[model samples]
Target: MFEYTIIDKSLENKIILITGAGAGIGKEAAITYAKLGATVILLGKTVSKLEAVYDEIIALGLAEPAIIPLDLKGATKQNYIDMSATIASQFGRLDGALLNASILGELTPFTQIHEQIFNDVMKVNVNAQYLLAQALIPTLQLAPNASLIFTSSGVGNQGRAYWGAYSISKFATEGMMQVIADEYENSTLRTNAINPGATNTGMRTSAYPAEDKDKLATATDIMPLYVYLMSDDSIAVNGKTIKAQ
Candidate 1:
């Protein structure tokens, strides 16, 4: 894990948005942020899952989280723009955003990759991130210090066989993070990517069904890096991809 102390209420008064808040790492991150006194916006495709997380937060006496149901595969640039506008109007500013939602398309041979699956993967993992980041930049800038975190994988920077479109999309994600980080290097907004290594997520099970999930780290186990990246401690850290073990 990244070396950073988890401080109590380190994120007090912060407004943070997390995609894929329905489950896995995204879900854990949302709950963790709320525990640290952030007003979390749980954005996911499933309303029920969002509500469940919201209820959990409320039960824990954490800040009341907001929910936004959005399907990135079908959403357009305008949708993101409208969403960002609403966030700005409601909260006045955004302190952080963790872009964690992604789809793991079928893992197949490079030559045997399906056109539709590849397109769908790219649409959710790359294009939607591009549009969403563009829309959220202004709101993120409103804070004294802000962090934009993109979720990445082990194969993102280094390619692996049979990873197909998923690998390609993650490379694009890393590239996108770097470009945004460079553009905002002098500003208060800092962009970085986290490669959650072999966490036991649903996507992980789908990708490697026979793997020993019991040996893998749970989402909660890798949150030190997640919390550090979103905290003010990492304001000077930008344009880099850090691993969460």
Candidate 2:
């Protein structure tokens, strides 16, 4: 048996923020959440892509989602702060946030990794989450309950050759979830990580170029867990990494 697909309207009126929402898993999750009645804030680097997702959500007659064009790699602390302020001013609180944006640096030997690539990966994947968390905690607290979801990877827990900086960043992503969860234990925030195993996203294609793409699940297939975690149904689940396969 499996979980994550039992849908309910419990997410009605919830305010959620999903990073990297332009495409891939993040985009799919945003649409799914909107259908379930949550007001979603789409954050991504590409305005056009974000607009497309926004149009889709609106076309479906779901909640009108908001868009924030943000490049995680270059986003500053003030950007995070301004985002939090905007969310607070607009919605008064934030019920959930999925840190779903990440970049996989070159899949090469660790010794062969270029410095810029490494920095870029770490900055987008790890540092951005830290800054966002710091900025959003107050807004999250304004909610009755809040879920902080991190997009983790299997390679984060186990180091594999050629995974390089991407792997390292994932490991740190999980650790950040644990640390944040521990610190927020008695608070309204619950931090958790989800590892979307072997999904059919562009990132997966780059990682396993020769693999049979048809056999892999699409981004929509892994969205059940995203919905469950963001809904009140999983408020008790905290400080753990879950696989979305």
Clashing pairs in 1: none
Q: Could you give candidate 2's per-residue lDDT for residues 88-176 as a string of tens digits?
A: 99999999999999999899998999999999999999999999999999999999999999999989999999999999999999999
Q: TM-score for all predictions?
A: 0.99, 0.98
Error of 2 at 162 (Å): 0.7
lDDT string, candidate 1, 9-124, tens digits: 99999999999999999999999999999999999999999999999999999989999999999998999999999999999999999999999999999999999999999999
Report each candidate's C-alpha RMSD, comma-separated, in the order given: 0.6, 1.0
The local lDDT score (0 to 100) that residue 89 gets in candidate 1 is: 96
- Candidate 1 — what's its lDDT? 0.96
Which residue ranges in model 2 land beyond 4 Å of their true spot? none
Task: Name the weakest run of 10 consecutive residues (lDDT summed) in model 1.
Answer: 1-10
Winning model by TM-score: 1
Best model per lDDT: 1
Candidate 1 residue spans exceeding 4 A from truth:
none
**C-alpha lDDT (0 to 100) for residue 46 of candidate 2:** 99
